[model samples]
Target: MIRAYHQPSAVEEALALVARGAVPVAGATGLYTGRSRREAELVDLTGLGLDTIGIHDDRIEIGATVSLQQLAMASSLPGMEGARLRRCCRHVASRPLRNMITAAGNVAHSVYWADLPVALLALDASLEVRRVGASPALVPIADATHGGKHAWDGGLITRIVVPRRAGTLSFGYERFTRTATDYSLSTACVTLRVDGSSARDVRFVVGAVSARPTRLVPVEAALEGSALSDDAISRALAALDRELPIAPNYRAPAEYRRELTQVLARRALETARTWAARENP
Candidate 1:
């Protein structure tokens, strides 16, 4: 159980508490969801003023305390980034839960089965964190989640930053579950830039079945410079099944997840195509 709760008034104070074994909490969604078993002191992060969302140098900087409901507001998102964020945030959960979950917390906790991290991963997002007794550094979303090379390691994630594309960019995100509000059994996201009819800079991320979101590199490489056609999409699906290895669980068999991955991948590609057409046409 949490023995004490401390709401530090400054960012440095929070970092100090984190270095001393106190758990820093912005949203505490995962903390209270039985995911965090061991607890020390709860360092409340709300008082540190890490709740602003702003655009600087075409980068969207979201405070660690920004809630899902706040991000779900489409009007607040400036461009394609806003549209993509709203698209994913709307499916997060009911109103009350969205209000309680923080965007940075969503990425920081690295819940493999969650949506926000998967979406952000596909968007090529990064986090700004302050480590104990160290200068703040920006870590890629991939590394921060899933214990990648640059792990969070008890650091306080202060903000989430993603680039704003200056040109036409197509992207899509989709998740599969037993129900609309249920945690996804698997999730996929796609982002690509189009050069005429050819797909370029393709990023395909699959999540929820593993400890971290993964890039479908083989599939992405297959579609990288090719025209997105029915045959190509089918080939990409084949490559996904052939190249992406999945582990089975009681809730979802490996075969089932493999097939579901294809379905979600196709849907995301279709969504990307649709948006690309709209932006390019």
Candidate 2:
């Protein structure tokens, strides 16, 4: 059955309610639709003044409560940092769903098919979370999703921080799915920082094909200080597992998903390479 729904005016009150077993839900788009049976108090975070966006010192701070629609419509990022995020947000789902999906909710729930995690990983984003009776803490997206997801239990993500790079940032993203709103079969997010034709930093995140997102560490190392030419891209692709252990689903076979990952990842890196070349030219 249904019960209490509280919307606290302050963070402390919200924390207290959660400490006492209240479940936090903002943009309840994913929660209400899912076939969940257990019920409890719902702490609506529509208030508490957490839905603000701020920019400073080459970084953009996105409130956890900020809706995907809000982010999709953002005018600009100071240095165009994490530019790929806007596209990711815009395509998260249909218009109605995007309007009700909160950034915090999306990451907290982290439906395996979610795109935000890969985007955050590519941008090296960090999260700010508040725990029961404890001061707020900053955690890297990688760390927060590591080991066990229990890191956010009894806590709530307050904001996400995207650190801007000083040099030109080249970003590319691609998602493979049968339909526009259908969950992706595989997704790739890549960001490259190039200085005078040499790659300074590269982050390539592959998701939606496994239980957890995985970074191509060997590929990233190979991309360093080199222009991602056709040969270079080929070499990186060769390093990937011939057959990734992607869990099979009704939407696609595991082997097919692995092949798609290799293709999309190549395209993403190649596009990023072209963007980097533009910086030096």
Candidate 3:
């Protein structure tokens, strides 16, 4: 038996309600784990006025309740480095599921294969978090969503803000999956910003290969100011060996995942470079 479901239109009211032990549920799609016996207050965030998808200066502010569908529809959001993330969100589960899956909901769950958080980290995004009787503050994407390193206590993710990419940018996503809708065995998000013939900025992120998203910083550092070469890509891929250690899982063996991560990361980077060349030319 579920208790009362409160719908507050403002953040203060919502915080007050949540401080009283209400479980904030933006979308309940991922929380059906046969635990109905342990029912608690489900605070529906649908009416919290947190469903905006618009560009706020150089950053794109995505309200916590913004659905995956809305994300897909607004693929051209300012500062959205790559549409590959939106593409991943669009095919997540099914139409019905995407209709209910919220960006904040998915991130809060911190599922292994959730793609948005990984992509957001690559874009250098920040999350606006608010808690009961505390001042709202922005936390870097890396620190804010670090798996098991830190936890958000009594804090609600209000919005996600991503820095706008300058110059020509390209993005690609690689997911190892049995089908389009299934959770990824491993996924890669790659983005490249170009200035003339040189790579201005490069980002590579792999998901499901570790407990949290691993940003290939060594690879990014190595590729900056270099042309998109097969050798450069190989070096970037090699950097993964030291960055991530995949654990054996039901979906794939540790070795298999490690190799797939390298392959996918390379392919994603190549694809991004190709698109960047075309866009900048």
- Quote the positional error of residue 71 for candidate 2 in Å: 0.8
Clashing pairs in 3: none
Sort by TM-score, best first: what order?
2, 1, 3
RMSD after CA superposition, every candidate: 1.9, 1.8, 2.2
Clashing pairs in model 1, backbone N/Cα/C closer than 3 A: none
Model 2 agreement with the true structure over 1-281: per-residue lDDT tens digits = 54888989888898888878888888887775432225568888889898888988878899988888888888765654636778788787788988888888888876778778888888888899898779889888888875565467777888899887787879778898888888889998778887877776788788898766777777777777777877777777776654244776877777788889888988888888877777668
Winner by TM-score: 2
Displacement of residue 172 (Cα, Å) in model 3 is 2.3
Looking at candidate 2, what is the lDDT of residue 116? Answer: 84
- Model 1: lDDT equals 0.81
Model 1, runs deviating above 4 Å: 32-36, 145-150
TM-score against truth, every candidate? 0.93, 0.94, 0.91
Show model 3 residue runs off by greater than 4 Å: 33-39, 79-84, 146-151
Q: Count the backbone clashes (under 3 Å) in each candidate.
A: 0, 0, 0
Question: Candidates 2 and 3: which is better by lDDT?
Answer: 2
Clashing pairs in 2: none
- The lDDT for every candidate, in the order shown, is 0.81, 0.79, 0.77
